[model samples]
Target: MHMSPVRDDFRRSQLAIAALFFLLGFQYATWVSRIPALKARLDLGEAQIGLLLMTCGVGAAVSFPLVAVLMRRFGSRLLSVISALALGVVLVALSVVPDYPLTLLVLFCDGVAVGCLNVAMNAQGAALEARYARTTMSRLHATFSAGSLLAALLASGVTAFTGTLAVHFGLAAALLAVLVVVARPGLLTDDAPAAAQDGPDQEQDGPDQEQDGPDQEQAPAAKKDRRRFALPAAATLWMGLAMVFGTVTEGAMNDWSALYLKDVVNAGAGLAPLGIAVVSVMMVLARIFADGWRTRFGDGRIVRTGSLLAGAGLALALLVGGVVPTLIGFACVGLGVAAVTPCVYVAAARQGSDALSLVAAMGTTGLLAGPAVIGFIADATSLVWGMAAVAVSAAVVSLCATRIGWPAPEPHPEPHPEPHPEPLDGRLAPDAG
Candidate 1:
């Protein structure tokens, strides 16, 4: 079991992770973007919808780490399949369930499934370079954002043509059918009960690592425990910060964009999709090339720079409030956040491929934590202030990234030999870079 050949296998594994993100995207896009439509069907007010949205964070918080531990213990392949199927079923429930409380309950379940799926996907993505010696997490997350953009388009399309919940729900189900097929081959990785047997030490390392030494040209068991999570730690903080800023802007667009446009900008319901979908477009484009920036600059510096831009964008939106400034603000924020999650998780993988699960879990917590805190603020104070809170959070994220990844991890051996030489250009970990 020399790990030198695993590089190709790990790269191949990335496609599976991408498809998983795509599937997850199909659901999440609807959650944020479909509010106006959902409000019509459910006939709910702002506060109630806010409460329902909050439930999602609660459900996600509970489910993520549990799934991370399970995926680490059991295996990504199995847990992911189960989680995906459950997510689809719950999505259908979200579309049809008219009862407000029932909808919240179902959304909770959806969050649980999505949270679990996220942990499983990142654990797998991190393993690509973590076990193989190359980059994978950033590209995989780029795919994740791409999937979200795709869903944004799909959502707009569905809204335009039919404007029916049944049609949208059916589309989700159809997408899941394709996802199940694509995900099946990967699911087998988790079917065994082997997870229970793995001790905490083994579980701490996300997946199997059959490699050796601190440098290339392989052998065995100089297995570096490499617990200095500083790089990923910093990356994780920035990621969380990005989520806070991005989600607020995102939440605004999701929950209020249409309303704002309809009321403030005096636009019709149909055209209001521009507010959210436009940002999605920016994010999709940015993720494709963001790594190049990170490679030249560093994740820490880039993220901080992005945060400042995102915060400035928020200010622009707040101050200007007109269509052009608002759009620019949204675009800036989208571009700022586009590459962040990928950068962070990839940093985690680089630290120790074995620790991918733990690091991914920790990283996802930042996502979960930011929303919960913001949701409470939105619930208590005004929504505008809540958004301002997101800006502050991003600034805080910038500070945290600086602290988390300094004195980067010691260099480790290449886990495998590759057809291509490893790219010498790389960035600081996501948080600190």
Candidate 2:
């Protein structure tokens, strides 16, 4: 009936990481749900709004090198807390920005904070999995969806009473501050080094080990060499590609599904929002259960099967050309791809911090760019073709999932009594479901 200190620590770390995930989603949705208010306040047209959104993505994409360096120097725990606090402050700034140019600058900074927190939080999640020899990433992602949904509902409720950005965002930021403080103490420290050393890339012969030099000389060289950015390994590249395509599928749906419903399916104004609602609901539900699926089928099977389901289902919906089938298709896309990014993050983190940072940045780019790309395709051709492109993105994810080297699940280790237990120091372990 009693839990060991190590087990309790694991539980606390899991909660802490989950809270960080929730904060990320909540903070993002809080701003996103208020875009209309922001647009009205700035007197911005659609094109200008697009530009503002794109700036955030640009910032996230360009943050890869910096995130990698900070993760190595500060570790994920400190970096996660710091980036999260910065995100909270930026949220407040977003509510009060005086001009469009200044707003763009703040959003760019917001994106950087988002990128940093994204990588850092996932690193913490990966470390938890490695240490406990369990699956938690999927459920942690579900908390993110839950947070977003909560923010959306809160925004709606607050809008009914008032359209004030300060009231809604101020409340959201305050909640984020509270969550950050609560999560800070429970986060694990000293795990980043273990994760990096246990990564798949560590299989290569290091200069310190392979070169015929003194330990004193080679150690400094090796340390310095690690600080420089190297090209991602083949496996890392494949994982990053999967991440890109997976996010493209997700982001395109959020931006396009409602428009697709209205224009293609000829749905009423009131019913069109259901397109987003269906996908969001199904995705949250699927993520809630996805960790179990990962445990039973392995990460490779989950990614491949889910990606195929999303691509094929959407393609069928587009071919059928009806509202009912289209909504069903959106639901399929949501349910199928819900676990893709989380699974990819686990795989990338196992490749090391550089791989993790690169893959996360790639995902940020896909999320921001995919919808715009789809818009161009729709303009050049038709909305059907645009939707078809999304299906292609999902298919690409499936294909890349096949090429990446997935780690075999580790067997559960026997229980130990050490106050500080060592991590499995390799990869995530599959558990009996």
Q: After best superposition, candidate 1 residue 283: deviation in angstroms? A: 1.8
lDDT by residue for model 1 (1-433), tens: 5544454465456677778877887678766788888888888999998887778867876664466456545566666777888887886777789788898899888778877777667655644443344444556666766667778898888888888877887787778868877756643242122222222233333333434322341122122322322223444444444444444444444445554455665666776777777667777777777755665665666666776776778667867777767778767777776655665555443333233444444444555455556667767975566557766755554565564452233244344354222231122122232
lDDT of 2 by residue, 29-93 (tens): 89989999999999999999988888888988999999988987788999999999998898899
Query: Which runs in model 2 stand beyond 4 Å of their true positions?
Result: 4-6, 160-162, 204-228, 410-423, 428-433
Score each candidate by Cα lDDT: 0.59, 0.85
Q: Write down the TM-score of every candidate.
A: 0.66, 0.91
Residue 291 accuracy (lDDT) in model 2: 77
Q: What residue runs in model 1 are displaced by over 4 Å at the alpha carbon? A: 1-11, 30-48, 92-101, 149-171, 184-278, 312-329, 348-388, 406-433
Model 2 earns a TM-score of: 0.91
Highest lDDT model number: 2
lDDT of 2: 0.85
Over the full model, what C-alpha lDDT does candidate 1 score relative to the true structure?
A: 0.59
